[model samples]
Target: MTAKKELLGSLLFAWGANSYGQLGLGHKEDVLLPVRVTQGLASIGNIKCLVGGGGHSAIITDDRTIWTCGSNAFGQLGLPQHLGESTLPLPIKTLNGKAVEIAAGLRHALAVTAEKGLVFQWGVGMKSLANRGLQTLPVPAFMSAREPCEVPGFGHVKVKHVSAGAYHSACITDQGWLFVWGSNKYGQLLSSDDFLPLPFFIQPHHFEGEKITLVRSGWTHIVARTERGQVYTWGRADYGQLGRKIKSTQDSMCKSNVIQSRFTPEKVPELTGASQITCGSEHSLAAVGDSILSWGWNEHGMCGDGTEVNISEPRQISFFRNYIPAAIGTGAGHSMVLCRSAGQSGGDFKACPEEQAVCQGNPETATT
Candidate 1:
């Protein structure tokens, strides 16, 4: 018998802010409703992964190729030329057979390969050899040392996951340990130093002996989840991105709720049993069973509560009721929710709203 592997669902949809064409809708406009983005991919097996950063979106084909769009301001798109941006999906040829998963930051991207667990990175501050003086590129170059380069200090261990924040990056090892490097401004890397020049293992006081199952970073914050779903958040919280609220001990008339930032990983008492978690510039999204919860900066409705209120408390998005979210993600000012119709055992999607605010590809090609 021929060999077979598990496949991911095919119902890819995007919505919310698209100022930089991060939605890949062929135009720079915000989408208030869900729009299909599975174009030109049915012929190439299943689309396994989707990732969003400050102003970019990416997808990985089941065949292990990468396609990206949106802002290439710092060569994050891995293109041969920095044409500002692309409103349509363009292939990143350099990562073809090399990446198993993609992680992105505000101005950078990381390709995680299982082979020796190598990580190839591009974008701002990625050229740093000693992790000190780094430069940013405004134009895209070929995917070589000038564009994409393998991380030197982390080739010894096998990384199973990778994540990128604004100026820093992180990865989880097969043994469930977390390693990070890059700018530690705001203490996002949990190090007192300014720049990490190289990847270093982080042993958070809160995670004394627990194994980390997943780790994600935002513009200036980082969150890690243990195998049992316990979550710890740290870093910039000026926008309440740490899922924490400040304490006010002033007199009754002078009391005010102050949002504070954290420099150490503190367990968020409200979150548990999260199967998946993702972070935006100042917001966060997590999945628990069929329910999805959000918190932090909601300036542009990235919280998806149909409101633009910055909150530190976790709130559930009722719109996803009765829907089984297969995957959830966040962008700088947007959110992407991929769900399969409830009651369907497979990755089959149900009918979505019919309205052509702006169209790309054949909508008829999406399966229900």
Candidate 2:
């Protein structure tokens, strides 16, 4: 096979502040556009997935190996024991098997391997903690995290998906089980109706069985949409991110505001026929029947809508309604969406629908 086959495609990167060379654009300037990341990885091909942590970033391939660059201050790069910046792409040997998907927090990274279960993380973000130390790749302390610990769960169960947020992480198993961990500052870890005020620095059972088909983690909240298309959310909802209009309910998991804490999952009105969803740092967007609506934070026009610097509740972004987004990715301050124009054709490969979970990453890892 050609080398390109192994590398996926060309590397893609974008950085708002490149002072630490997080954008890998060869210079320490803020990159406003997505550019090629050629510092470390040269032989890789189509990038299966991309994740950002604080200022650093990581990309995984079909080969199962991971390449990371940018920030290492908190070891978000997933490289060896190092601080500073990578300046180039460095290989992560710890994750050898094919990684199906990955997500990033402010200072940590999470990955789900083809092996069966998900791997725990040891780095920064909401989970960062008193040990707020840094490492290049995962160290023994990281792998065996204690408080805000990486506490690898799922036992032997097969994890189907995983997502990371600013201070929290989330996942879904093959059987449709959902899990949450880290930062409870906003009750992001309490998945159930009865939640404690204390946030588990480690993974905790926020909610039980909801038959979730997909789950995505935001900077401070976690969203899971069930197979029947029912969306659930936990964590902070300062901007009505829970989808439900802020009301007088002051119960934990169901309550919001200082009057009552511990908000729970509530149905988002008008978010119907949603095939998929992704979350930005504080806001959220869902692809519903060829339309896109956003809520929560929109401070920098990240929502793609014309104005409204901040979206307190669910709002519509009509700009790209007609374009069908095949896939979507959200960053702390930015978002990436793959819009497959209708009538356009490519390699003999026909794109798969969202239900398949066909396998995330590079074409090398794609299954027929």
Q: What is the lDDT of residue 74 in candidate 2?
A: 66
Write model 2 residue lDDT over 1-368, tens digit each, in one string.
32233222323334344555554455656544333455443345455555555566566655656677667776677665655786666667766456767777777777776765655564644333422422242323543331123344466667767777776667767766666655455656654422221222223233344466667777777777665565667667776566655455445453235423325565565665466576767767776655657777655455667454667666666655545544445555554444434444421112433212432211122111
Candidate 1 C-alpha lDDT tens digits along 227-251: 6567888888878888876544465
Candidate that would win on TM-score: 1
Cα deviation at 157, candidate 2, in Å, is 1.2
Runs in model 1 deviating more than 4 A are 1-10, 33-45, 125-146, 246-261, 348-368
Quality of model 1 by C-alpha lDDT: 0.68
Clashes of each: 2, 27
Candidate 2 vs. true structure, TM-score? 0.72
- C-alpha TM-scores of all predictions: 0.82, 0.72
CA shift of 117, model 2, Å: 2.2
Could you tell me which 10 consecutive residues in candidate 1 have the lowest summed lDDT?
353-362
Residue 115's C-alpha lDDT in candidate 2?
A: 69
lDDT of each: 0.68, 0.55
